[model samples]
Target: MNELLLDLNEQQRAAVEYIDGPMVVFAGAGTGKTRVITYRIVYLLNLGVDPYNILAVTFTNKAAQEMKDRLVKLFPHKAENVWVTTFHSLCAKILYTEAKNFGLERNFVIYDENDSIKLIKECMKEVSVEPLNFSAYDIYELICRAKDNLIDPESYKINTMVSHQYYREIVAEIYSKYQKKLLENNALDFGDLIMKTVEFFKNEQFADIKNKYAQRFKYIHVDEYQDVNYSQVVLLKILSSVHHNVCVVGDDDQTIYSWRGSNMNYLLNFKKEFSTKDIEVKEFKITQNYRSKKTILDISNILISHNKHRVKKVLFSNIEGEFKNDVKIKQCEDEYDEAEFVAKEILKLQQIEKFYNSTVAVLYRTNAQSRVFEEVFSEYKIPYKIVGSVAFYDRKEIKDIIAYLRVVVNPQDTVSLKRIINVPPRGIGETTILYLETLAKENKTSLWEQIVKIDDTELSLKVKNSVWKFLSLYDLLKKYKDTMYPSEFIKFLIEKTNYIKMIEENNN
Candidate 1:
């Protein structure tokens, strides 16, 4: 037996060694699923499979990176060849290489949620649909859901039904105009990355392109498979159509992303989708609860068994201990009472069990649920830090800095330019910016270009001076773009833009 197989349990070992056909691992919570996945890749490599021919996809960047890091430690020489990335990242790579087939440039901008909302709002305004009546956010979400289901604008208009015909008509128009704007700006929203890749594969003109990738990746591994949406399902199916050597690891009970279009039906129906005449899909279950005690596992199993759609599997504790008192259930009158209970429980555990405050943690379903917990904890003076609060990249300061860099690289990125143009109290009021946007639209030019030719536009002396100062700063950054390293350029931008001073004043 290999060193990799030594550490795995019976089911984990079986899963790692099974490379004959399509397989689905019904991995229970905390059953070393990630470990099984990493070892399975190693197992294939030991059989003389080329690392370049394998693809391992997961949902989050953090998980993908962790897998890559583990592989690097095990196979430092061959790890670089493996395709370990998120679904969106894999699609982005494919799209970047074959963008021309879809009439998109390789350097097309990828719009974030904020940019998408801004574009949707613009489209709504153009179609004379007021934002107050129909929120831009809601419309953007509808568009995203449509894209996730692989429905194009024309298909959406034809198939969609709403109570009010006028509202449906307005949304359809906005969807059409929004897609047109995305193309005109050479941009793709987050949903488009997966939707476009699926589109490219299904297009008959790109058969060779699809076949190239299908033939390239012989073994495909998808983690958290239950959270896959329709577009992603189509993508995996197309990629594995040739070889049929796909392995997915997930539990139907763990499907929590339905609002984001994730369908557990895909995982539940894996065998039906992948089985063929020559090869049969194999199902494996790893039900050992490595992270919990027997009492807790018993309670969890009993509670989750009520879910009608999940696969029936019993989780047994791998650990041997007398943990009869481990399971506890408490009922509270309201959120405030629940929060108080949690805070008091934490304090009691720290004092009675001699546990460190740093070792204790709390988990919540949504961001809004954290407010009560925070209030209770603060009142108790409990030393704590929130995990997964607002992400670093989502911070206003971070976004403002990134916008500056984006405008420097792509002057036509009006979304990013719009974000930073009036930032730092530039005195570039909304009315002035709106005027420039109107002029740019009429002239068929970008906002950056309009700003560059601002001297020719009709504007007040005060507004013109502020605008010129901003342009001068932008031009200086553009001049040093190639000369300075990224770090130095960022420092120079902070100093030149007086960004730190603005942040200080705002904080005050």
Candidate 2:
């Protein structure tokens, strides 16, 4: 046996060595699914398989990075050749390379949630819909759900069934306009990354491009298969259709992203989806629980057994000893009671049981549930640190800086251009922006292009001068764009735009 397969148990060893055809591993929680994934890659490498032919995808960047780090330690020389990344990151790379086929530039900007909401609001305003009547975020989510299910704007308008015809027509119009604006600005939102890649592969016009990638990646592995949406399933199926060498590892009962369009059916019917007449899809179960105690595993098995649709598997603790003290259940009348009980329990655990605050953790289902616990913890004088209160990219300052960078890279990015045009209070107000938008609509051009031709528009001299100053800032940055490295250009942008100075003055 290879050294890499020495530590795995019998079931995990079988899963790692199964390289003949399609396989689905029903990996229960705490069963070392990631370990099996990484070791399987090692097994393939030891068999003289080219690392460049392997592709592995997971749900989160952190998970993908962890897999990559483990691979680097195991196969330091050839690990970099494997395509280990999140689905969105892989799709973004494809979109960036083949963006011209989809009528977008290679340097297209990717809009975040805030940018998408802003554009949705603009579309609503253009279609004569009041923000008060319909929330911009709600509309943005609708469009996202549509895209996740691989529904384009035209298909949404015709096939979608809504309660009110008026609202349906309104949303369809807004969706069409929003997509048009995204293209005009040379941008794609986060959803567009996956949706467009699926589109590119499915389009018959791009058969050669699709075949090239399908042949390049001979083996595919997907983690968290239960959390993949319809578009993702289509993408994976298209890529694996040629070779049929794919392995998906996930527990269907662990599916929790249904609110974001994740369909557990894909995982539940994996055998049916991948099995062919010549080669039957193999199924393996890794049911040993290494992270939890015996009592916890028993309780989880009992609770999850009641689920109507799931693969039949029981998880047993691999740890020795009875371990009967881990399982506990508490019921409360409401969130307040639950919060109070949790805080008091934590206080007891710290004061009497001598457990450190760092050793204890409180898990909640939703972020909104944290408020009550926070209040209760404060009353009890318990020091707590929220793990992911606000994502780094979602911060206002970070977004503003990214917008500046986006504008520098792609001048047609009107959403980013609009975000930073007067960010530091350059005297060009909303009224001036509205005027420019109107002129841009009339001339059928982007906001940046309209600003370039501002002299041709009927605007106040003061507004025109402020706009000219903004244009000059872009001109200065464009001059150094090819000359300086990306890091150097960012530093130059912050200095030339006085962004850091504005932040310091505001803080003071």
Q: For model 2, how does the per-residue alpha-carbon lDDT over 213-243 read when each residue is reduced to its tens digit?
A: 8998888999888899988988998989889
Q: All candidates' TM-scores?
A: 0.93, 0.95
Task: Write down the worst ten-residue block by lDDT for model 1.
Answer: 157-166
Candidate 1 lDDT over residue span 1-508, tens digit each? 4777998999999999999889999999899888888889988888889998999999999999999999888777787689999999999999998888767887787888988998998998898887789999988988898888898877776665345666767778899999888887778898999999998898998999999999998999999999999999999999998988999999877868998899999999999988988889999999987898887888889999999888899999957557548767799999999999999998788776567888877888888998899899999998778877578888999989988888877777888888888888889989998999999999998888899999999898899999999988888999998898899999999999999999899889
lDDT of 2 at 338: 98
Local distance difference test, per candidate?
0.88, 0.88
**Candidate 1 displacement at residue 465 in angstroms:** 3.9
- Overlapping backbone residue pairs in candidate 1 total 0
Q: Which ten residues in a row have the lowest lDDT in candidate 2?
A: 318-327
